[model samples]
Target: MSLPFNNTCRFNSVFAGVLCTAALSIAPVAFADDGSEASRERALVIVTSDSLETQSMAMILSRAMQEQGSDLHLLLCDGAGDLAVEGYASERTVAPRDIKPEGLLATMMNDGAKVDVCAIYLPNSEYEQDDLREGVGVAMPGPMAEMMRDPKIPVYTF
Candidate 1:
């Protein structure tokens, strides 16, 4: 079963690519005109995993988009789902900077970003609703469906 290269890196890259492709495939079919009001306030939907680098990047990107006046919605799933658990983000993934993903998530929340943990998180993980940090909510299918159907919003995965 041994491979010539690092399997972890290979798996991660392939997984990331698949996720990105799925996200892109669900893109809204319509878009607001260039000068329209809707075009001015675009929304960003981020589906993130538990990878430290991915979480950090998603948070950083979310913060940047927020600064640009975009509404941010973050969906935490799989390993990334752990970030929603209170006091769980203890490891700092980014080196030299000492910034933790949880901290960035909190900043996004403070900036009015909507943070949601996947609906199946509790059933699939060892966490109860109370274990989730304050302000983190269980993602509902209805709203997510709407977001995916909205052409004005851009969906990204990390």
Candidate 2:
């Protein structure tokens, strides 16, 4: 005894199998999360700046990094600490071309980037805790150092 099917039914079954195989072959590539090239290109940026030009450049770089879906973390030290403090940045500087570091820090925070000021700098300087601008967090040297050590974390100092 033999099982038999019409030519039309045989064609339909073969076509259906081909469609199923094609769909399966294409589905994984479409939905797989194997850490593609785009994901591998993601990075962490650490900006340390005490100069007005450096601070301004850091802000621009942070904005561009965020636009490209990279992570940015800023550590303010030395005179850069002044950037994290309120009013000091604005009141102390009158350079005609100087970009207010405080404002740049604020914009960075608003963009979901993390801004950290050296804890040692906070108390030694005249800035009070409240004087530290909004969205600025305090970090000790150790963690900042560790972050800088990561090969994937690019450090820019100015």
Candidate 3:
């Protein structure tokens, strides 16, 4: 017999939590660099989701990785591209947490993390580089391609 829909949803929620926990636990170990040429502690975070939860998680994770000596690059595309716009208001994702994703992104920038929106974002959205917040750039194809080809750097997507 099939379980009720709500029960199935609950089960899925629990499963997703388990997966998130497992992924977090494994992330550092899997990406740690032992000062080796082949394994540098660098990360590329590609965020295509504009949803508050997803962007918040990406920002949080990227900051954590930076704290661990990983150089981080945040590439925003699709819905997430809106995040790079200057003075863009962000919806709060976590309760009892005042900082929104936009604030977190600023903090990350202050920490020297690179932020880039897809090159097409501006043209397609009728935006220009000057329309973005300071320090945010358009992701050029050449550098983006190079980043992807660097096997030593791991990528996290949200």
Candidate 4:
């Protein structure tokens, strides 16, 4: 006997097919390992902001890179140096609000990520050596400039 004329079944079947196709398309990106991403080897992220949101996004990206087993180096230069200042805190409540730079520095250090502050920016700032949070290192502009030139290193400036 033939099936009843239920157009709903045809629609449901088509919908299911579309869902399966979408799932297949996305599954590889979601579950695939980072070993195949050649660019994941080394990454450099530059944060030039003291903004909460910018710092937060940088931290999140750094964490993701580390999770993928990439060597991550974060450079804080220009206005971003404010983040490395000890006791620096922002009271702003907004979309770009993020953990204090000092806090992010500590977290990144704990996660085996390197945190560097531009020396050129340092001398001009009010931050003394003692003002910098622990586990953060000094990076001269020369070295940072060179690192930024490396083709393999992906630079994200904020």
Best by lDDT: 3
Model 3 per-residue lDDT tens digits across residues 57-148: 88888888988878789999988888899998875556557658888888889988999999888888867889999999989999999998
The best-first sequence of candidates by lDDT reads: 3, 1, 4, 2
* Structural similarity to truth (TM-score) of each candidate: 0.70, 0.62, 0.72, 0.65
The ten-residue window of minimal lDDT in model 3 covers 32-41
Screening candidate 4 with a backbone cut-off below 3 angstroms (N, C-alpha, C), the clashing residue pairs are 52-96, 52-98, 53-96
Q: How would you encode candidate 4's per-residue C-alpha lDDT over 32-132 as one tens digit per residue?
A: 76665553577888888876777777777787778878878888888777777777775753345434555656777787788888877778987777788
Candidate 2, 49-96: lDDT as tens digits:
566666677676767776776666777777777777766555443356
Error of 1 at 120 (Å): 0.6
What ranges in model 1 sit over 4 Å off? 1-40
Native-structure RMSD, model 3 = 13.8
The best candidate in terms of TM-score: 3
RMSD of each: 16.8, 9.5, 13.8, 9.2
Model 1 global lDDT (CA atoms, 0 to 1) = 0.80
lDDT of each: 0.80, 0.70, 0.87, 0.76
Model 3 Cα displacement at 3 (Å)?
Answer: 68
Q: After superposing candidate 4, which stretches have Cα over 4 Å from the reference? A: 1-40, 92-101
CA lDDT of 66 in candidate 4? 82
User: Which parts of model 2 are misplaced by more than 4 Å?
Assistant: 1-49, 91-99
